[model samples]
Target: MYRINPPGVYAHESAMTEPRLRARVERVAAALAPPRVPVVFTDEQLPELIWEGRWTEGLKPMGTLPEVRDPVLVFSTFRFDGKEAERGAWFDQLGTGIGGHLRNALVGGGAFHWFPAGLKEDPYRKEKVCRACWRLHFQVGCLHRCAYCGYGGVLVTMVNVEEYIEHLDRLIERHPWQLTYLLEDDADVLCLEPELGCLGPIIEYFGTLKDRYLIIHTKSANVEWMLPLKHNGNTILVWSLSGPEQSRTLEPKTGTLEERVEAARLCQEAGYTVRYKFKPILPITGWREDGARAVATALTRTRPDVISLCTFMWMECAEMVRRVGRDRFDPHFLAAAEAAADTIGGLRTAPFPEDARAEMYEHYLTEIRRWNETVPVSLSTESPSMWRRFEDRLGMNAANYVCGCGPQSTPWLRQLPCSAWQGVERNDQGLRGTW
Candidate 1:
C-alpha cells in the first residue's frame, strides 16, 4: 500500500462519531495526494449525474476543460444533517491526474436500491437466463483504466455508509429468500478503500447476520486492511481475474495476477471465503496456455470455494476495434465477430459465437478440474442454452447451481442439490410480492 501520510491524519475534522471509523477514513485520506480542487455537493445533482446519465449537464459546472491538470475530489454533503454519527466526506482521487481527461463516466449511483438482475433479459437472446439474485451497489464508479473498459473517470462514493447499511439490512430482511447480496457489479469497490472506509463496517455487519452473505467483487489487491476484520466467514471476496496477456495489455492499471492471487490467499487465510471470476476472459493469442497457467498459479496459493468464468462481453466487434484497437482480439474470433456483427446488432453478449464461448469455458473447466475436481464452477451471466450445454460437465444446472454470488450460495452450503429451489419461488429480490 502507498503510505503517503502518517497514520490517522485528517485534512479537516469530520463529524463522524465513532473514533475507529473516523480513524479509518482519515487513514485512507492521508494515503492519497490531496486534491487541487475540492468540490462538495449538497443535493441530487451528483446523484442525477451518476444515476440519471446526465453527465453533459453535470460537467457544465466544471467548465469546458480539455484535461484535468490537478486531481479533483468531489464530496457530497446532502442528507448529512447535523448528526455526528451520520457524517462523512465523499471524494474521488487516485494518483496525480497526469494526462487524465474526463472522457466518460460509469459512476455507481449514490442510491441504495436493488437491481433485478435475474429478472433482466439478455439483449441477445431476449430471455431471462441469469441466476436469480439481487445486484447491490455500495458505491459507483471505477478508477482503474483498463483498455477494454469504459467505466472510469468519475467515482461516486456514498459518504453516509451507516444509512446505506441500514437500508441494505432492511432490504435483506424484507426478502428472506434473497440470501446473498452481490456488490461491485458496477465498481471495483476496494479501489476506494481506506478512503471509503465503509467496506469494513459492511463486512462486520454481514458477520452478525445468519444465513445471509456479502459478495464483494473487485479487480483490486487492496486486502491488507480487511485481513483483520470480523467477517465471520460471511463475506465472499471475489477477484475479477484475467490471463497474463489480458492483464498486461488490457488491464494495465489494475493489480497484476500474482498480486490478486496473493491477496485472495491472505483473505482466505483470514477466514473469509475467497472466489475467483475469470470475467471478460479475452481469447488473445496463446490464451489457453496463459489462462491455464494463471488458474494453476491461483489454485496453488488459495483454494477458492467457487469459481466463475465469463468471456469478454462489453464491446461490440466494431466497438472493440474502436475502443481497444483491432489488434487486441484473436484474429479468428475477430473475423467471426465481424462476419456476424450485423446480425448481433447492439446486443451485449460476448463477441464470440456460442461454440467459441463453449470451447473457452470447457478449456477453463478442464484446467480447474485438473487442480481441484470438486470446486463448484459455473458460468457468469451466460445464456440458458450455454448453461444447458455444459450442465453435465459443470455438475450443476442454471436452475439450482451455486454461482460466485447467488443468494443461496452460503459458504457452509457449498453444493446445493439440483432440487434446492423446491418450495422457494424463483422471484426477483426487488419483487417480494411474487414470491
Candidate 2:
C-alpha cells in the first residue's frame, strides 16, 4: 500500500495466484536495493553514446530498449514515467558536461561535473578543474515525444551506474564544494527508472550527503515506484512544465498536464520538495491564458519550493522538428521558429522576438509570480544578452538550481552577448511595459 500504484495491481493474470504475485513483487522490490560495489568497468564495459532518435516518428517506445534487465522489466509494467513539463536549458547544460565547460568554466554554463570518460584529457586520467555543481547523470536520453525536445529518438543508456556512483562518491568525499548535482539529462531518470533500477538506490545514496541537493527533472508522471522509498528530503523532484495547451498538444506523449501536477503533488505528499520548470514558454495564440492557468494549476497542486521560468530558445530543437515532425506540432510554428532562429548566447535558437518576447515574458512572469509569492521563482537566461534582458527585472534569482546560469555563471566571456534590447532598461515594473 505504500506505493501509489500498489504492487501487483498491474501484474498479469497468470501471476495473480496470490503467493506467486507476492513473490514476484518481492523480487522486483528487492532488486531496487543498491548493488554491492566496486563496479568494475573493464575495457569492454565503456558506455555507448548514440546520437540519434530511438523512434522514427515520435518518441521511442520502451520496447525499443535493447536491455532486458530486471529494472527494465519493472519499468515495462508502467505506462509513462515521472514528473512533467519542458526545458531547453538542459540542452545547453548537458552539451557542456558532454564536452563543453560549465558556468564555473564557461560563465553562461553551470558548475557541472561531467563523466570522467568524456571529460578526461587522457582516457583513464581525469582533467583538472576548480569546482562544479556536478552534472552527474546515471541516465540520459528520453522516450517522451515532446515537440520542443531536442534529445529525441537518439536514446542513450548509461550502463555504468555502479561506476558512476563510485565516481560521484569519491568526488564528494574529496571535494566538499561539489555539493549540488543534476541527476539527469540524457534521459528522464524516472521514465526508465524501474528498468534502470537505479532511482531508489541513487536517492538513498545521495540522502547520506549533508545539505546536498540532487535535482531530478522529468516530464513523466511515473512516480508509483517512488512513494515507498525513504528520501530524507535531500532529493528535489522537478517537473519540466509547459503551457497547458503545449503540454497537451505539443508534448502529447509525455503525461497530460493534470497528471504531471498530480504526480508532483504525490511527491510533495511523500515529503519530497517538488519544483516546476516553466521553460521554453511558447507564447502562441492563447499562450498567455493557457500559461497563466497552467501556473495556477501547478501552484495549487504541489507545494513548489521554486518555480523556474524560461521562454523558448530553439537551439537545435527546431532542426529536430524538421527531421521528425509530430502530428500535434504545427508547421507554422516551425516556420516562425525558423524565421526567428538566430544566434543567442553561443547557441543558435529561435529566441522570443525582441518586441513580443519582452511583453510575453512580462505578462507570464507577472502572472506566474503572482500565484506563488513566497516561493523563489527562478528564470532561465541562456546568454548574456538574455541574462541582461531578463536579469533583475523579474526579481527572481539567476538559477543554478537547474540551468546553472545563476549569479555565478559567466558564459558571456566566450560568447558575445545578444543586443536585441540595447536601448531598453527595466522600468519600475522591471519591464518596458510597451509592446
**Candidate 2 error regions (>4 Å):** 1-132, 316-349, 396-435
Clashes of each: 4, 29
Deviation of model 2 at 63, angstroms: 20
**Cα error, candidate 2, residue 415 (Å):** 26
Scored by lDDT, model 1 comes in at 0.63
Top-TM-score candidate index: 1
lDDT by candidate, in order shown: 0.63, 0.48
lDDT of 1 by residue, 18-79 (tens): 56545545455545664222222332234333333323222221112333121122332113
lDDT (10s digit) by residue, model 2, range 160-244: 3443455456555554443446666556767655644567777877777786667787888999888778778777777888777
TM-score, structure 1 vs. true = 0.78
Model 1 steric clash pairs: 28-194, 108-140, 108-141, 180-407
